[model samples]
Target: MPSRSLTDPPRIAFAGTPEFAARALEALIGFDCDIPLVLTQPDRPAGRGMKLTPSPVKACALAHGLTVDQPDTLKTPELRAPLVEAAPDLLVVVAYGMLLPRAVLDIPRLGCINIHASLLPRWRGAAPIQRAIEAGDARTGITLMQMDIGLDTGPMLAEHVVDITDIDTTATLHDRLAEAGARLLIDTLPDLLAGRVTPRAQPDHGACYAAKIGKTEAALDFRRSASELGRRLRAFDPFPGGLMSVDGTPIKLWRAEVLAEPGAPGLISRVDDQGVVIGCGAGSLCITELQKAGGRRLPVAEFLRGHALAAGQQAQLPG
Candidate 1:
């Protein structure tokens, strides 16, 4: 742990939810800094029973015996009072899933800082990790910025990039970026406290918003090139996984490899222990892992044992 000899460690109020945010919070705790309060989204219905479940951040905070608040809306004056009461010198937001109105941003003495998943001025909106991977970018990383009212328009304090491997899935990339962001935050906090690092304005020219990934976007379209579908397969893995329909049944694709071949789109060109190679518009995709709706995820050979998928069978995918 880096030792600081300031008059006092700045009071920090963290706002976030999900695993990514939890990682940041954990890093802050490990630094032995003062965390007065944590704000996370309210627990909501999840999974089969649709029962309300606390976010991972909330659970982690409680386990650490830290104070936590779950406010549905921060736009109102009444709801914003608690944040003021916390009297945080700095506000750090990460994957909070809610927009911060100007009032909340102005509450902290040092202003609010955000841990964004992408290199800002690039994928500026939500779902940056998924969008970067889906676009098949060679690299993506984390950015620490001073928050502004506009969406992720904050000036950047620091950034660190990581290469995107061919096999890197959304889940894998998300974890790596989160860890990287946490380290960057720790390294930059001293400069922020000393008022040494000036936040630089982001270039407006290359700004692009990463729209939230939709459930329907997970369905793989065979009419598209194998490389395109392959990117989607990697981008949506572990959540809203890529899918294709065969005989009106939905098959979730978890792992796949692109191959050079030509045949009718959606046609099963080959079937082997590795997987069923399905033809695409330009090439083919060998699906290694898959799952049927209401069925367990299985290897290609195991899935083939229960469900008959032979060569020459036509598969339909959503557009």
Candidate 2:
């Protein structure tokens, strides 16, 4: 590797789409890294109007005055040709949504580096942040790995861990990990450019795939223990929140805590200012916040004002 002065920054091509991806781009740009081009997912229909909306990464790239590309697919020769022409020294990929073929991966001189949301060899697929909390993992973190053809089976260059708390939600953890990943990437860039960073292969043991969260998974199953239900409620809080049916209307569980006692699952165990205490298979859950179909999130007291949830009544949740 040729040694260049700090003033001569490496030409980097950043590929990503979501807010998490934007954070890394922001860090790279903050350090004035040679971001010659930014590639993100194509704009798609969003919101009630279904108007095409640019991804967070695209918006950030444009804001930074960086050249942007919204390629629908990189497998095409036309799309991959321009990226190769750019002659980027390194490619940085975050949540870009589309898989990169080997042809595209081999374009950059230093190959591609990805800021994955989880520690490699564990939670290697999509939805790692949510899955970690849903499974009640003790800790989760970020891994800067070399991109490969395999599903996040890349060699890791760096990693940082963050402990998961009982009250932590997916939103909170995602933000923290994104910031951590950005700092780690920026700190490691100098070494990466100097060819001092060595990639380490991940172990096959303790590997788990975090399948993307589906709408059906949002349906709360009260038959599960309170602790398990509580984790789901927290894991899915902001998106596809743990849901139940009340008079056939889908009710979202926004906030909840587990209780120690046993009762009939889905039974209304208690009701208080905080919220309603619903029984699970082995324990109970005190729902502090909730929302009904076509309704806004509200505190338990506020929700009770508009709806009736009496003690002893059953709350049926989908399995």
TM-score of every candidate: 0.96, 0.96
lDDT of 1 at 182: 94
TM-score, cand. 1 vs. native: 0.96
Question: How far out, in Å, is residue 255 in model 1?
Answer: 1.0
Question: What overall lDDT, based on C-alpha atoms, would model 1 receive against the true structure?
Answer: 0.91
lDDT digits (tens) for residues 236-272 of candidate 2 = 8678898888666678888997889888889887887
lDDT of 2: 0.89
All candidates: CA RMSD (Å): 3.0, 2.3
> Model 1, poorest ten-residue lDDT window?
1-10
Instruction: Please write out the lDDT profile of model 1 over residues 1-319, one tens digit for every residue.
Output: 2444657767898999999999999998887478889999999999999999999999999999989999999999888888888888899999999999999999999999999999989999988999999899999899999999999998999999989999999999998999999999999998888899988999868889899988999877798999999999889887799888887877888899999978789999899888899999989999999898899889999998998888988889743
In terms of TM-score, how similar is model 2 to the real structure?
Answer: 0.96
Give the Cα lDDT of each candidate: 0.91, 0.89
